[model samples]
Target: MSADIKAWYLSKTVWGGVLAIIASIANIAGFGISGAEQAELADGITALLAAAGGIVAVAGRLVAHRKLK
Candidate 1:
């Protein structure tokens, strides 16, 4: 109902994390990707996680420096 709640659900970072987790679980369950596309999938997952980490770090710094609301 609240804007913050809706905003969080629409967050790219949140979705990225969710997708990464799901992919990891699928891979662990023997449904892992292979062949020519595996490398592309791995690269995407890596970038997604890395972006989430970088964003969180930047947000934290901004909050600490009194720049973010």
Candidate 2:
């Protein structure tokens, strides 16, 4: 694949993974529940943030790529 594609893939994968881990850790630490409730809320918030981050990242990448093109 081209460098641009590779870079995009890397950015999305790496940053997405990082954000997910962070959110998970934050939820685990932020709310000290150890059962279903904890998992539910933490996973919910983390998924939400991860989705938002992915959207922003993709949009930014598209804009930057457009500019480069």
Candidate 3:
């Protein structure tokens, strides 16, 4: 695999984003998702994605800062 694809697979944040997208697709397609509990799961996944985004942003800034130093 290319370095780019390998880096993507190695990133926890990217994995979280991918999972979030998949979960949304499943919810949209109404595949085995029903009632409040399942809906709550979606909400949790969204929150998880938010957290992963924050982590990625902070890490990116750190890398940029170090590179520019």
| RMSD list, candidates in order | 10.3, 8.1, 9.2
Candidate 1 per-residue C-alpha lDDT over 1-69 given as tens digits, one digit per residue, 9 for 90 to 100: 575574454455565566667677888997864433544555566667667877998888977946545
Clashing pairs in 1: none
Candidate 3 lDDT over 1-69, as tens digits, reads 575564344455555566667667887888643445455655676667668877998889988846653
Clashing pairs in 3: none
lDDT of each: 0.64, 0.60, 0.63
How many residue pairs clash in each candidate at the backbone level? Answer: 0, 0, 0
Best by TM-score: 3
Best-to-worst order by lDDT is 1, 3, 2
Q: Model 1 lDDT vs. the true structure?
A: 0.64
Local distance difference test, candidate 2: 0.60
lDDT of 2 by residue, 1-69 (tens): 574564333454454555566667877888443345544555665666668878998889888845653
